[model samples]
Target: MSLLDQQSVFSAMLQAGPFAVGDTPPLAHPFSRETKAWVQHIHGNQLLKTKYRSVRNQIFDLLGIATYDEVLALIHDKELRTKAAERAYLLLGNMFGIEGTGQEVIRHLHEYARTADDVISSLRAKVLAPYSAHIETTNEIVTTWDPVELLLALFDDRYHKKARFEAKRKLALMGLAGSIDQRERETKIGEKFLTFLNFLNAFVWSPDCKIGELDIRYLYSTHNRENFSCSAVKVLSEEEARLIIPAVGEKLTLVKRRRFRDNGADIPIYVTIRKKEPSAKVLKLLRKNEKNPATAVDDELGLMAVLNSVNDVKRFVRHLTRSAARAESFMTLEDISDTLTGGEYRGTATGSSGKTSMLKFFARTGGMRIEFILHTNRSYLNYIYQRDVAHDEYEVKRIFDTGVIEFLFPPDIYHLDLQKIRDHQLAWFRRRIEEN
Candidate 1:
């Protein structure tokens, strides 16, 4: 009767009549332009950072996990050794975009489990803080706020402190204790975060993220990209849900699954197990949509994958900064204050509303090179309607102005597997997208 017994627990949990299969209704979008525009960072814990897909894939190679999702599920386990594999999986994934299926994940699982300092951290800073409502643009004016400032305001309220306390708990669960000042600590957690971000991209959020009175701020930056792609990973109620982890560790003990809500109000989902093996389904959709055959795919796609990744990153960083600055002008309405107090207006505070580009985007380091993603919020869609902004036109200009994005993960990501910076060039073009 070791805690989290596999067979009995699985039967009881899986066979239970009360357990939910899933929600067929689409989850609420958390990062609408309004919500996302305000959020620059997801509350800095030093271990958390801006997760890039290129870095995520590279880590897939080091720790021998199939994907970072598995690592996330495993990290919460009490069995340290089993969970160590999950962390290693993240390391390996950051090193290489893809890892071999079965044997390697198991083979390296032991070695990674043995290490004393298995978990690492990654730190990321957003150009915008919660109060910022403007973006600095060469052409358009922007506003900005410092997250530290928001933290100051939050210190007065118990709610913010509680939120931070929970954040700290999650960091500790990942073996990331109190904050570290060194870049080294950041690199450790950052790699893991990036990999996890890939696995949890579905929950990353929308351009808009309004969490009650808390305004998660984003930078308001602008670029000229006109066309972009958006990826959605949707699981229906009847679909099987599996946990993703690469290895096992000392504290990797399985526990019960708990439902939690994300900023947008969608509940975060995960798998629970009590034993050695983690639960996960090899991504069928990505595999099926993959244009390249398995044999011919690895090298051709791998090389271009890393290259295009570089380009997408550069652009995201550029635009994120711009977007973060865009929300400075919006002041809290006096009427809202009065309404909250039944017309007894309190002194107006800044940052009630902010603007965000409905166009959300990212660069994917892939089994195939996924160059650009242009994700936009339809909230401000009405404004663009009069201008007739074409997505294509915007993309062309963005890439032309910003060049290409690149991966910024730490070294040993793949131990030179993906370090190839072979001759790659970006073509020059003027393009724009219509937003009607």
Candidate 2:
């Protein structure tokens, strides 16, 4: 065959997504006609058939057709004909490259594509198999959403009022909601939140395991009981906690400080650690939000890296991502640098100037999920100010919203001057931003 003809065959194969065993090859609709013509031209020539007998046989098997005439008859079934033509194109292309019989192409297909039964069985063994062990105790198999399930729930409720409320809250926190139309604003927020959820999911489920087994206790020291005052805390071995904290913290701090120095900042880098999610927040998340307690409560153990400059923040994030990729302990997810802003709670200004970047990752062992919030010194200072100043009002609003104080305080009391408090925080943020 001419080089042009050979290129045409190879191009057609490339257009197909991937080859699978015992299934029709998926072909690009546009190339169907040319592919059919090429097959017919080769099939009709006895000399070509003799030289490419293996290719011809494989084509016949792929299309379930016995002869060249049978292949032509496939024109009546557009889908079948397209698939047959693609198979022929792939087979001929393989033969041309390897100068081998069509068996090579068949072998390659078998290697890459699993049969339907094989795929189903493999999935059952790898995925459903874990749950199978708990089948005897089905009643005891406390249901929990994996990251994928939580994501699906969010998508399903994309148009719901609650999701819209959540989206608006997200935008309000970012300080970009006022500039856009309500619908458009909600859509942007929804997209961003979905992206955030996706990153969270990946960070929680990398290496692909069931989510419920993730133990947060592995991330902190057992001596750090004070951090768990807010959550359903578990105290694991002090030795395990000690090993994890220093090993992970050292790497994270080293990266942050080195990056800060590299960015020409002579400031000290500060690292803050949280042992577990506060018990109250975990209950609220599980009951009010209907989130899977396993992956949903990711901040159960958290780390924050406070740096001296925004450039240092970016550098630290890059270094941490690279480090996670190299380390066996964790896998980094999509970075949330762009979405980082001030507080998400009620008291802080909707447009708080507390700027920070967030990176999330999944622990390879014990299914622990960890987050690192990167912040410049100024942003960190702003965060502290907003958090402290807003603490009282924030707690009051939370209590009212959760109905913890509904019996004591009337509903009208819930209408506090949240924006005023926010304005104060925003001023602080503004000053810090300006100073930086």
Candidate 3:
């Protein structure tokens, strides 16, 4: 029978008498003559099964089967009831559209059958048949990668050796002979020892980045914008100063105080010039996993420009791009401005505030790559707050989620007050949501 006709039969059965104790409390009123006939038809056909007393079972009973085992047996048996069994299989497959049973049946069919076209082949074909065009369109725009494959590559012996060689070469090129020798010595000790040494080196030695013959004084140079003055600047070296000055100047006009004030109010722009320092974990990641260690670590000699508003962000990017092209300093652009932050609390603060832009680009001059990050005021504030105040709390929570803290620390460590941190995050989230 069609599914609609079968549903009509079940509805009629429910309207009939002998309602089970827990099977949806009985109606307050008496059944009408029409309802009585429906009940009679259901009971007369032995549609009710006391053992399997669920609405699910009632539907299955309508298909002439008592249990899933019976259905499986029929599908597998080929001698006595070959034709009858095929018909039964077809009926069960048709019932896959009935919500809960559909998923269970698909999973079971996949598990039992060797070939794809066994029991529910027709159902699969019909259901997915309409989405071919949509799938094809999406395939053109999306880039897919396999995390499992990347993880496996990390452990491959040849891959590990290549990564190590690249790491040593980078250090040598940067004129860090001691760090290179240290890595070589560790390699001779043992694989585990080499890994430990590499981990230590990542934390101990910062990248030696020198910009050759590039005047970057403009980065640290003070400039006045109406009532706001962005004079807070630092220059590490002459070469760094040379490189940073020009890079910052390119986008400096767009982020000026006057342009920002035109939108609403003037905001301060904080610029910093310094050598990029990779964290121990980041260093280890590059040394052990990255195929091209050079590209993996950008921002060696970095310049960060923090300003207010989304408009300033757009103008900054355009100016930076134009400036880089004009000076022939632009190498590559890693525009992760559109990428959302990770974690359960992600999209809570930055995502909802429309302040999630983070643009990174590499500008090369004489074997030195200078990275720049442009941030909106809200994002900059959020980043500072999280990094300074909530970092420990977030890290602890992450470790707890991974179940590693229990193995490493005492139980009391887990009892640290996380409620306040969670509340703070929630408040930010709610505020951003409301604004959006």
Candidate 4:
């Protein structure tokens, strides 16, 4: 990350201190002083302390270090710091490079004040644009106007007394209602994400070599009959999805109800894709700093496959390896199936919570590294429907669990009770899953 970006993050942290709402002054302190204050605040709060350490440990692993001492020692080692900075750039700046210079965060309160109108306007447009046609369907709101827009606009236009109280009350109940200043950043990141997905499609279905299905059959648990294997050939729309095979419909519905949009089970492929959003990318970078942009890009194109049984999953993986070998593009593979299948849930986010079981590995081929997660029917069901283990719950947990929510939308300025919001989101996701 750039110095400016670091300062921006630090400036935001300062605003989270115990100052009155909108009463904090400009960040005029030296970097060390600002960092000290931030550290003091974190250390003073038990929850923040635990979450901060968790985030630190993740970053330490990404940087290939083990302790805080090494992190502090980097300042004196210019050579190591330069290399670390490059890695940090690749890690944090991976998504559209927006966190750094592309479109830097507005660090100062004065800067935000100057752009308040634009920020509020842009946020209003963003939150409403996607849900405009169906905004009323969302149970979160009962009024004609969105609470977030109304709150921000009222707060911005000098209606401070009521706005402050209402904003605090609503935020306490709802979490950070909408984003603050991520105006064009989301669109840029989404465009890149789509391009990355397209590249994955080309790689998987290339003319020279392609990932294909095996001719093997398995006695599906639901059908109790042997069925031919199938690969993901095409995506399905809601209408086509309605015509899903009876045996696969339930699993397909579970996967489709996931928060991510890039997944479907119209065919036997049972594939799900994962690409970190702009905010998620930033939070992940804040978690850990890895080697290169390849890891990030590979993650953006990560693929998951759910099959009838463990035997079938292994067969499918064998077919994948065989296809890669035939193309002479195979590099290496990591099979952690034994570990996951041994009743141990794989760690996620902070490496402590949001766990799930799956046969996971990474394959390097054709100058690209792709991750593949294989799941048996039973495990896949557990992944989606299991209590405290469902991915939807995981998604809701990680944001607040890692303290990224507070870092990005501090309670003092945003007036958001992150824990309350987490509960609301988790309940909301569970309701959607139930409806599905």
Candidate with best lDDT: 4
Task: List, residue by residue over 351-371, the lDDT tens digit for candidate 2.
Answer: 222232233343222233455
lDDT of 4: 0.44
In angstroms, give how far residue 272 of model 3 lies from its true place.
2.9
Q: What is model 1's C-alpha RMSD?
A: 29.2
Query: After superposition, which runs of candidate 1 have C-alpha atoms over 4 Å from their true positions?
Result: 1-186, 194-377, 380-392, 402-436
Candidate number achieving the greatest TM-score relative to the actual structure = 4
Global lDDT scores for all candidate models: 0.24, 0.35, 0.34, 0.44
Order the candidates by lDDT, highest first — what do you get? Answer: 4, 2, 3, 1
Candidate 3 lDDT over 1-436, as tens digits, reads 2111322322222212243211112222246664464366457455443322564364344335555334344334545234543444455445432124545544433322212111112212322223223212112112111111121222223333333222222221222222222332333323433332332223211223122212232224332233122334342344554455323212122222212222333334445555432232232222222223243344335666665556666665555455445444443555344331322222321113222335545544323445666665444434333322233233333333322222111123223333443345445533332231
Model 3, runs deviating above 4 Å: 1-268, 278-296, 330-332, 339-357, 360-370, 386-436
> What lDDT score is found at residue 366 in candidate 1?
19
Candidate 4 vs. true structure, TM-score:
0.47
Q: Write out the backbone clash pairs for model 2.
A: 230-278, 230-279, 231-278, 231-279, 276-300, 277-300, 349-422
Mind giving the per-residue lDDT tens digits that candidate 1 earns over 1-436?
2111222211111111111111211112455553363244324522222332333453344334565344434334447434454555555434433357645543433322221011211111111111112211111000111111111222223233223322222222121111111112333434534443342233222324322212221212122232222121222221122332212110111212122232234322222111111000001101122212232122111101100122332343343233333422211211111121123223211111112222222223211121122222221221122122333233323222221111111121112221131111111111112221
Can you rank all candidates by TM-score, best first?
4, 2, 3, 1
Instruction: State in Å the error of residue 270, model 1.
Output: 17
Tell me the TM-score of each prediction against the true structure: 0.15, 0.29, 0.27, 0.47
CA error at residue 16 for candidate 1, angstroms? 72
